[model samples]
Target: MAFDWSVEQIAAAPSITPPTLHKHYFRERKPRAEVRFRVEAKLFTVLMTETEARNVSTIDKYVKHFERHDACVPKSA
Candidate 1:
């Protein structure tokens, strides 16, 4: 599954800042339960509306995948 939403867009739906989402994306820190729930809720809503399919498990899979990946740092030129 793929989403066209950017970090900013995803964060906007949950009222989270882009930097916070970036931190999560890069595995800088684990997201708090409240933040994680909000993001999951947003994803659930969008996926249900767009595909008319229930995808909570799929969302969880991707979230866990990111958390398990090696930490990333932004590259500088």
Candidate 2:
């Protein structure tokens, strides 16, 4: 989903100042699944790189931890 709200649109909303909007809700929200997928893709790339470079041992713990995280984090509605 996309908000597609411009700064002017946000600031023009009832009782909302640009500074207030920025300080409180500047960043757009993303779904948990999207975030997880991006993270998994990046991690997979790094894992493959490390394996090819013979440095997989260095990130073994991280791979295990990320696997656990993937198993535990639920998809957002």
Candidate 3:
């Protein structure tokens, strides 16, 4: 007999991994923009892991949130 799938089971699978402290050390100097983006992404990844909310929609929300608020201030040329 085949096992039947349930709504609860499918919904429970949020595809979230536990937040592991990922520290990347850079020996050489790098561009400010690149470094800033990496740091932001890493922090976002950690938060997602902790919350167990890894869906694309949720991630997109965080990215937008950063762009609107937490991200670096733009410098007018």
Question: Which should have the higher TM-score, number 1 or number 3?
Answer: 3
For candidate 3, write residues 6-75 as lDDT tens digits. 3344233443222211122233225555656777778767777856864667666766876665344545
Candidate 1 segments whose C-alpha is farther than 4 A from its true place: 1-31, 53-77
For model 3, the stretches where C-alpha displacement exceeds 4 angstroms are: 1-27, 53-74
lDDT of 1 by residue, 1-62 (tens): 01324567778977999888777656533444445566668865766665556566776676
- Ranked by TM-score from best down, the candidates are 2, 3, 1
Candidate 1 minimal-lDDT segment of 10 residues: 68-77
Q: What TM-score does each of the candidates earn?
A: 0.30, 0.51, 0.35
Write candidate 2's Cα lDDT for 26-65 as tens digits.
4543554565577678878888888889896757976788
Q: Which of 1 and 2 is the better model by lDDT?
A: 2
Question: How many residue pairs clash per model?
Answer: 0, 0, 0
Whole-model lDDT, model 3: 0.48
